[model samples]
Target: MNVFPRLPDNLTGGLRRPNQVRRDQLEGAVREALSRQVAVTRPLTADPAGQAIRRANRIRRRRAGVGIALGVVTTVLIGAGMTHLSGGSDQQGPPIVVIGDPDLSAQPLATASVAPPPPPPPPSSKASADALFASALIDADGKRLALPGVGPAELAHRLPNGTGLLVVGAPTAAGRSLWVAQDDGLVQVLLAGAGQIVLAPDATQVAWRDGEDLLVAGVVGTQLIGTVRIAVPDSAQPVRFVGSSLLVRPDPTRPGHVLWRPGADKLTEVPEQDTLNVYGSLPDGRLVSQVSANSADGTCLALVDPLRATKAARTACGTRLSPDGVGGMSDDGRWLLVNGKVGSTDRSLLVDLERLGTTLDAVPVGPAVSGAVAWTSDSDVAYVDSSGWLVRLNVKRVRAGEPAEQTPVAGIEPGDRPVLVSGS
Candidate 1:
């Protein structure tokens, strides 16, 4: 029956009697909310709230260690400003070197590499006529005059300043003497005879022929000066120094026409009619005579201006020769060397008085051409060839028409008579 019926309000109230007033009203509302949170808390003190919470956790770990030491000093100032703006600071400094002057820089590159020294060798007229017969005091038998007691020295004259040697020597007892031979050893003699020995185009004077006397000597430095003696006409003939005067022929018995100029006393004749002699004087004082309009007409070679008694040029008519023909004038009178005969064959020309008659510049010289014919202080013509050989003919290469050269003078020996000493 109790399982079946429900209790009323008073019944239920009684059952709750054991609630102690609802557990004392829930323990007094949990001690009144823990006394209202212990009346707003406030009671801790280890020393002042435990050093104020250990100084607020050591100032939050010293402000997080000053923000991690200012983010590790701004990553070490951005890696030292990116290693100084990337040039890496010129790897950091110091090193360099240079020097030169080894004694002003040496030299000898072959004397600045070479090139300038080759032009001076053309004057050998057979070595100046073998050095004028090797300084001639004349002794290879007076240079072939065949000396012994001295009679045939025959080279009547020569001294185009190669010093001297005027031998007409015949001293077997001093008969036809005039033997000068001086290269400074002085010999002199003088008592002359068979004519022609005139040297003195400034070779300091020396004219000869002492038979009819016509002396005129003056040479200083080897001594022999002033000797004047002039008594001509015993048929006088050989004597020529023309130009400061003395070109005689007073009257070699007459055919030599007449040409005397010996002033200071008298003899001045100059007719020269068919004049057949006078070979050479020109260095402008002119007088290269050998004229003739008769004996069947031939020889004329003139140029006579014996002080303007005029005839300044001749030589055209027949170009003849042989009044004993043998010409020679070239101590710069330009050149003449004749020696004619042509028909019985003796011929030896070379003319060219600067082209004399417009075209016969001549230059034949063949018929074996022997003995006397010499010039070469570059006028070149030297001869001697009957196979004895000395030879040489150039004549400015035959006046430039070319074919003349010839040249064969090695030791000279066609009996050795080469006389050309005119190097002026």
Candidate 2:
């Protein structure tokens, strides 16, 4: 029978009978010792008291050394474990915590850590594609081109030149859309949802109202720039830009337009008109609009400066305002064209503004309110007749003895009325 010293799983070996073999060997050694009469006696102590004291001291010293060694080992193990947990090794771990996260379980970010790990950076304030929410043509070179319909209502206001901007209307279920064009036939949309589009007198900026908020987006010469929400307290807001100033009209009743410089903070008020709704201003310092009273035709076709009310900015060449006429100012701020059937007369009047006080011939475009009209940047007026023909009227020709009453000066076939969209 093999009797073996059983070992725990921590010690790995095969079974054997070392215990029995050791007992037999010990018995043999004892018998041999007895036979030889080997005395194993204790030697007499010369000083028993001193020996006992020395033995006790040795035992105490051993115990103290063991305690000290145990403490040192424990401290070493704890330090190693902490180093491993703190990313002290070359191994990778989980993501680090950030300031905005709700979870507090993650470890705090280290300020002087040598590791490359750090929190992600915050969002930047630079211009992004998402900032441009919507755009509609505030003014086009020619035509009203209202998004909901396809007639003169669609044409912006025709000018003596072929360039103009279409007034983009409010957004509906169908969507807010406006098309503006110049002689180059380039069309741009200023707003896409619901709102009213208006251009500044300088033709460099466009402003609109979305709900109760006012938004300005426009181009300075060729560079696009604007503010999203310019805070104002009232509704029926009206805005315009003249030179370097921005004017805002924010009252519902007895309202007046406020003017301010773009990069400055001061504001001033524009003079009030008796009945005309102010549409916009011109660079040459003229305000354009339609008459307030439906029955009064004189003021209906009048263009007067708010700064100087006595002097009419524009008036019919020889006759007063036509009863059933529609008009708009040229881009150069020197002419006004009224299109409508006047007092049973079928001729439209193209009035040269400079000749309002002189005897200038009124160009008679056969007595008919055709499509919408707008002036181009180059000073040509474009209109569409009932036949849907695009007519381009030359201001120089009308002034240089070409006769103001020429209806279809030069036009395209009566087919597709291209939607016109202009930059504010």
Per-candidate total of colliding backbone pairs? 0, 51
Candidate 2: segments with Cα more than 4 A from true spot? 1-171, 174-190, 200-203, 220-224, 228-241, 245-268, 275-284, 288-303, 306-326, 345-347, 358-362, 366-379, 396-417, 420-424
Per-residue accuracy of model 1 over 1-424 as CA lDDT, tens digit each: 5777666564464344444467788999999999999889586654787888999999999999999999999999998875643222121211110111111113211111112212212324322222223311222122312111234443444545665555444234434445444442223343333355555655566666656666665655334455655677676755457776777766654545334444366566554555667767767666776676654446656666665554436554345555653556667787877766656666666676655661234556554454345555537655554453445556666556554434444444445443323323
- In candidate 1, stretches whose alpha carbon ends up further than 4 angstroms from where it belongs are 1-132, 135-197, 200-215, 218-221, 227-245, 248-258, 261-263, 279-289, 294-297, 300-319, 322-338, 341-409, 412-424
Query: Residue 403 in model 1: shift from native, Å?
Result: 26
- N/CA/C clash count, model 2: 51
Q: State the local distance difference test value for candidate 2.
A: 0.46
Please give the CA lDDT of all the candidate structures.
0.51, 0.46
* Residue 290 Cα positional deviation in candidate 1, in Å, after optimal superposition: 3.8
lDDT of 2 by residue, 1-424 (tens): 7599666443456544344457788999989989777566656659788899999999999999999999999999988875554422222222121121111113321222223332212223522111111121122333222221111224242222324333343446644444343222223343444355556544556565556555565443212354544555656555445555555655646434565554444445555444234434456666654443334344444454555436455543334444433555666666667654456566556665555543334566433445345566456666544554445557777556564333322223345443333222
